[model samples]
Target: MRKLLFEMAYDGSRYHGYQVQQNALSVAEVVQDAVEVVFKKREDIVGCSRTDAGVHASQYFFHMETALQIPPEAAVIALNNCLPGDIAMLSCTEIPPDKAADFHARYSVCWKEYVYKIWNSKVKNPFLQDRAYQVKYPVDAELLDRCAREFIGTHDFRGFCSAGAKPTENYTRTIYRAGVHREGDLIEFRVAGDGFLYNMVRIMVGTLLLAAEGKLKEGDVTRVLASLDREQAGITAPAAGLYLNWVSYTPFGEENPVK
Candidate 1:
């Protein structure tokens, strides 16, 4: 009878993805069961994003309708106690009655941020084994930043998405923030946009890595975006290196701030 919104983070090393699949463990499935244990049976549970296998999330959201009369704050604590160690509930909110009736986790999203982590070191990093990409080659952070900024504005990102993914006529997306940073051996590629196609962030990181290493082909970044060809881009970065860093929703009645 009421909708509850919860933000969470999960280590995607084990589950298949966010959504549930037959014969596969999933983050949503675990959370859904935990919520059922704490609350009355839910009409449905919905997540904000559909992450690929081996991908991690530092921040995520889900909303569900249930008949339980428990407070949102109380539900958060109870759900965390029931969920796995890798997944933790950050907070819980009760959507306004007016919005609850119409709100959707996926369709209402305004923007999302994805981060690709790379440990640029000759030696392997034990701490970040499955959490980040360990590259033996030398990657200049300045070069990466320069190349990354090229993708800051809106463009057709068809080349940055996975070739195997479903087709879409609208390949254009607006990037709000795009940058690369380095600290010691840790290199982070951060990108925030109105939305993204499947595997778009990973492909962009792969192309940026080539530019950082001075291996990018002529007219790569811009030409690739215009060509709308997946093969023109670099390799698909490993899923383990990608993270759903953050998500933001547009206020009711306002359009997505695409820029």
Candidate 2:
């Protein structure tokens, strides 16, 4: 068996999400179908992450094991050619059997970066309507940045996670970076962390915005963190504004990690 590590990106507007769903189209199903068209058949195409409905991925990783000995460059060409315009395969790497025996895409990751985009202007930009969360209320950019700082460092994120998410003893995760960046009217909230719970990033972004709008009081974020209560946090932001920005992976037990 030959293991193929593949990278792809998608504009998620037309699909439900990354995973296959019953009675709905998905990015993974579309990619697998395109692969079948090119490679005849392939199995065990494992995805690295599960993105929510309508959330975009600037890049995503998955793996497949097949008997075919297709070259990486040829595989990339064939898959891209077969895929629709919104989804395209970017790279393919064939791992030697010795290495493939141990590599698991999802568990080998060292960190992931998720970005949330917000269009804070009163006037909407037609181009960014689908790409960003547009809010008519005036946002205090500085306040948003200040409030986001509370999320930095390791903390129990049970308060930020959505309800009905499976209970786990280790709800703690590290936030290496969390901040707000503004490009004209487009405000981007970038958070890079070791890992995330379900809906964690969206809820964090929502809490920061709530502080800006006075729905949540100043220094309330620290209280929310200490309280470990989801009710104390802000509303969950819409899925359209969330993006799985990029995932940085490291070879197990190694000093240098690969992007």
Candidate 3:
């Protein structure tokens, strides 16, 4: 058997999330169904992340074991044909089984990056209404940037994670980089970390928004980080603004830069 890797991108507006559920359609379910149709089997594909409902992905990864002899490029085309318009297969390739393991494998990941988009304008743009967080009140990107800097480095991110997260799991995670920037009317929050808890990015963005809006003091971010309590954070931002931007891995100690 050969391990096949799929690179995919999806618009998450219509799906419940990236994971399959009993009564809901998901990006993973649709992609898995397409793979099943091509391979004539079920549960062959395993996704790298479980993104929340309405959270899009510019790039995502999954692996599967297949006995088929089709070339990787052909697999991409074939899968795209079967997938809905909103989801597309960007590439496909075969890799050693060890290389195909998710983020768990040693020397497998350098970092993971996420981008949260905010539409800061006097009026919401119809085109971006479903893709960005629309805030009528102006946001100071510099202020948000200052707040984001306080979150960089290792910390127990409990204060930034959703209260709905399972209590059994640990909330500590290491953040390598976190920053905020502005482009035209868009305010972007980019964060890179070793791993993140459920709804962690959204909650972080919400807290930063509060800081940008002057509702929360800039120093509050440090207080929240030190608090280690979920209640110390602001509300979770809407899922529509969140995107799984990229996954990075290092093998042979070579850095794989994310675009």
Candidate 4:
């Protein structure tokens, strides 16, 4: 048996989420269908994260164990042919037998990066209808970018997480990068962290939007962080705007530079 790691990108507008569920369509379910077609049997796949519905991914990873022998490059093409247009299989690599025992799609992750896109303008963009959050009000990217710095460093991110999340032993997470920038009318909130609680990135982006709108003043983010009060944080931004941008496996390492 060999363990294969697959890289993919997908538009999540039509799926419930990444995980398979009963009575609902999901990315994993669709991908599994394609995998079954190629391998002539069901091979369970494990994904790196369970992204919320309508949340896209520019880079996602999954691993599966199969007895079939196929070159990694050829597997990519075969899978893509079976997959729908919204999902693209980018690459596949086999894990060495020695390393396969320790490798995991989720547990081995060192960090993940998420980005929230906002289309800030009075005019709605038909092209970005479901790709970005359309904020009619003017947003100050420079100010939000400065305020976003407060998210950097280790902290208990419970305040940024949504209520009713699955109970976890700890809420502490390390943020390596947090910043907001604008290109034309699109504002992007990019955050990188060792791990994130449920809806953490969306909440952070919403808090920054509040800062941009002058509803939250300078230093409010720090206050919210220290308070550890979820009520103190801003609203949870829409799922449509959030995208899993990057994932790193190297221990205590920066992400590889990519376009």
Give the top-scoring candidate (TM-score): 4
Question: What are the per-model C-alpha RMSD values against the true structure?
Answer: 3.0, 2.0, 2.6, 1.8
Lowest summed lDDT across 10 adjacent residues in model 2 is found at 250-259
Local accuracy by lDDT, each model:
0.85, 0.85, 0.83, 0.91
The estimated TM-scores of all candidates read 0.93, 0.94, 0.92, 0.97
Question: Considering TM-score, where higher is better, how would the candidates rank from best to worst?
Answer: 4, 2, 1, 3
lDDT of 2 at 41: 76
- Between candidates 1 and 4, the one scoring higher on lDDT is 4
**What tens digits encode model 2's per-residue C-alpha lDDT throughout 1-259?**
8888898888888899999999999998988887787778756578889988889999888888888878989999998888889887888878667878877778767788888999988897888766899988878777788778778899999999999688887999998888888888888999888899999999998899888788876678888988999998888999989999877776323465543
lDDT of 3 by residue, 1-259 (tens): 7777778899999999998898999998899889988887774567777899999999888877888888999889989999999998998768856645443312344667899999999886989966999988889999899899888888888787776778746777888789999999999999988888889999999889888778788788988889887777888999999999977654222464321
- Candidate 1, residue 41: Cα displacement in angstroms equals 1.9
Model 4 CA lDDT for position 64: 96
The alpha-carbon deviation from the true structure for residue 10 of candidate 1, after best TM-score superposition, in angstroms, is: 0.6
Residue-pair clashes, model 3: 0
Residue 5 of candidate 2: its Cα lDDT?
A: 88
lDDT by residue for model 4 (71-98), tens = 9898999999999999999988898889
Worst 10 residues of 3 by lDDT: 250-259
Model 2 gets an lDDT of 0.85
Q: Count the backbone clashes (under 3 Å) in each candidate.
A: 0, 0, 0, 0
